[model samples]
Target: MSSATIRCYIGIGSNLDVPLEQVKQALLELRELPESTLIQHSSLYLSAPVGPQDQPDFVNAVAEINTHLEAHALLDELQALEQRHRRVRVQHWGPRTLDLDLLIYGNESIQTERLQVPHPFMTERNFVVYPLAEIAPDFIFPDKTPLSDYLANCPMGKLKQIQI
Candidate 1:
């Protein structure tokens, strides 16, 4: 793992097993990650499911962290957290007990078999983009485009912020 610290944004969501509590617990777990410091987190929001309509609505939030772990290692830790929550991958964009996505990793653009920085679908997902903009309003994409640019095209849809 690189000794250099990188700021990362993690997108959190859950629609099963008491989603509100699951997301809350995930934020707490993020604070305890080895070699990482939780910087700030966005307010939780409720949004309609992105894929199948048969599932429950999701509770979402974004967290900022500074970490000494390499990108893949960070990914490993995030997945481990998911496993601890009993996350299952039975369908695409399916209901999950917990969903933790590495939305951004500093300014680096990473692409490998196991991970992709600046999560490919982030810009199009209001749940990801809105919560991200909440915590990092001035954040620019690794490609140099301002986040506000995406906000213009991505409608808020049914997303609603919830008081925790």
Candidate 2:
């Protein structure tokens, strides 16, 4: 592995098949990823389904990692981990066993056919903002704004911190 390591943040969420356990297991698996050092994780938060409200609420959290792997490689690894837990992408923002999102990779703005760094909605949603800010309060957005500001602006409706 290279000596270089970028600070990366990932969003983890689950609402099906023992959702709380799924997030916890994913956190442990994240620490075991090759060539990566698990930094820390935020406390889990419960949030209403962002899309269709018919499904169970989601348990969400964020993780910080120091990794030698490039952005896309890391994304692939996350997806593989989700697949290991039997994640099913049946509908847009639908319920799932696990959902992992690459939020930021050391200030790099990445756009590809499969991934988007900064996570597109990281700045707006309470589920993303609260947990991410909890882990990386000083993290800056692509547009040169601090994460805490976004977390503060997010509406605190259905998001509640929960131990999982």
Candidate 3:
């Protein structure tokens, strides 16, 4: 684990088993992560499933945190939280009880067998980008692109913010 704390953003989504409550619970759990503090989070948003529309709509949000844990350790913690929520991976872009994606890690770009920071597809997904823009409107990607750039090109489509 790194002693230095870094600001990070996590994308949260769920389309199964009371998705609204699932996202809310995950936000609370994010606050409890070891070596990390949840700084802020975006309002819950409702969005259509990214793939396989046969599933239910998803509830999504973005969380900002400062963490002393290195990127992979933080990823571990997020995955553990998902397991506690009973997330399963049986199909590609399948419905899940909870989905936690590490969107950015302090302006660092990371790519490895197990993790990717500034998640590759975030720029193309309104469910991820819109909620993220809500919490960190001025954020810049590791690649030096402004969040606004993606916002300008990514249509909201069916995304809608909902009060929980």
Candidate with the greatest lDDT versus the true structure: 1
- Each model's lDDT comes to 0.96, 0.89, 0.94
| Residue 163 in model 3: lDDT | 68
- Model 2, runs deviating above 4 Å: 1-3
Screening candidate 2 with a backbone cut-off below 3 angstroms (N, C-alpha, C), the clashing residue pairs are none
Per-model TM-score, in order, reads 0.98, 0.95, 0.98
Residue-level lDDT of model 3, residues 27-118, one tens digit each, is 99999999999999999999999889899999999999999999999999999999999999999999999999998999788989999888
lDDT of 1: 0.96
Superposed on all Cα atoms, the candidates' RMSDs to the truth, in angstroms, are 0.6, 1.3, 0.7
Query: For model 3, what is the alpha-carbon lDDT of residue 155?
Result: 99
Better of 2 and 3 by lDDT: 3
Worst 10 residues of 2 by lDDT: 134-143
Residue by residue across 58-115, what tens digits does model 1's lDDT show? 9999999999999999999999999999999999999999999999999999999988
